[model samples]
Target: MSLMTTLMLAGGLLLLNGAAAPAETRVDLALVLAVDASFSMEPDEQDLQRHGFAEAFQSPEVHRAIRQGMLGRIAVIYVEWAGAFDQEIIVPWTVIEQPADGPAFAERLLRNPVHRMGYTSISGVIDFGIQQLRHSGLQADRQVIDISGDGANNTGRTVTLARDEALAHDVTINGLPIMLKRPSSLWDIEDLDLYFRDCVIGGPGAFLVPVREKAQFVEAIKAKIIREITDRSNPRSLIQPAHDALPTNCLAGELRRHQPTAR
Candidate 1:
């Protein structure tokens, strides 16, 4: 069967055979995990990040969050960002409604090979995310772009320019700022949180969560997922597909939409 057909079957199966999720959900939130693959982040930091997301998807909190959403599921995609044009979609939209669905997705995410494209272009990821969200088939009240990175946007149209454009369309964008030990070289960035707060993150009720240490990555991911899944301030933001990435799918591919323009 086609992937889309499989997804329909999966959603139907989950609703009939799987545990219950919410109904009439307005938001079809898709987390565009905009990660930083810049040269500054060390190998250990990268592993911590990758594993953190994997672990979060497996957590009970995430499961609870999905169950709490009006639609009880969410579609998600992952991207690694560095240069203005260096963004690569590492994961495609997969819905997770049942408890088992979340863990399965997480496992797949854990196994997906790394993409090494490097640049620090937060705006590039946002632009790419806009395209993904626009092309994703589900319709809802809110569109979210969860951008996580360790540096300011030194590339692409100025970060604020891109962010403002997204906000204008009523899209909510959250931020995850990674603050590891400063690098001894140019790749290392300081004041990352401030930079993200001032230039990178924005949207209705947009917020930035700081990853204070490498060890805290997993916890941070869990917290973010909980907030994304459970919060109803933007009832339209609740996703109904279910889980974020666990085991990444190679079948995930970009759709045919004009990319989000960098304003």
Candidate 2:
């Protein structure tokens, strides 16, 4: 059977199995947190990236965030991506319906090995998240793609096209921009926040925040996610407003024809 067919059959079984039980299968709020693990993310930085998330789900804030969602539950996936084919789903779809379930899920995430890949294809990673959700089953109140990256679109598909595709289908794209030192290669892009705004974010009430430093990554990730799950009109925490900048890419003119996502 095709993957889609298998997923459908498996979901049917799960529904039947839970039907006789007292409680309903947990609400299916799905969040795809795509982390950038490109060459730019040094090993220690990557460890910090992983640790920040592990710590967040275990935090009181995240637990409270989960409870405040549409049905007091959400399922999440963690993927680390770099290059055109560097996508790896470190954690599969797991439900967090209670306080206890949250921490345990976070522990499983902590054990995954972090591999350093060399190129940064932000759109490649977004595409992977979109595909994962297609097989995720239509059992959720919302679908989200949260991406954290440190650079502009230097490879693979153009960032705007990817954002439009994701947002076109109501899949909100929130961004955590890891802006480090600028290199000659990313000349026109003065700040990653701009790249994320014009190219990486969309959907209902989409937002972007900056992980200004390694230490800030933990808090940034936690705060951003909490607001997302809670449907906060504005992030209760600080977030950088979008900074519009013309695509500084030398070949941007030729790529603009890629078309906005028609999803």
Q: What shift in Å separates residue 28 of candidate 2 from its native position after superposition?
A: 5.6
RMSD over all Cα atoms, model 2: 6.5
lDDT at 120 for candidate 2?
Answer: 72
Report the lDDT tens digits of candidate 2 across residue range 1-263. Answer: 67953654333221221122122345646788899888777788788888988998899989888887668878787888888778877766667776787787688788879978866777788888888776664366788999987766556877677778887777989888887555434222456676676677888878888877777888888888887888677635345446434463533322332336310
Task: Write one digit per residue (lDDT tens) for candidate 1, span 1-263.
Answer: 67854664333211221332233323445566777787657777877888888888888888888777777777666677778888755555566777887787777677776666655677777787787666555455567888887666655666677888888877788888887666444444445565566666677677778887777788887877677666445434322224443432211111101135311
Query: Which consecutive 10 residues in model 1 have the weakest lDDT in total?
Result: 249-258
The lDDT values for all models are 0.65, 0.72
Clashing pairs in 2: none
Q: Please, what is the TM-score per model?
A: 0.76, 0.80
After superposing candidate 2 on the true structure, give the runs of residues whose Cα lies further than 4 Å from its correct spot: 1-28, 182-189, 235-263
Candidate 2 steric clashes: 0
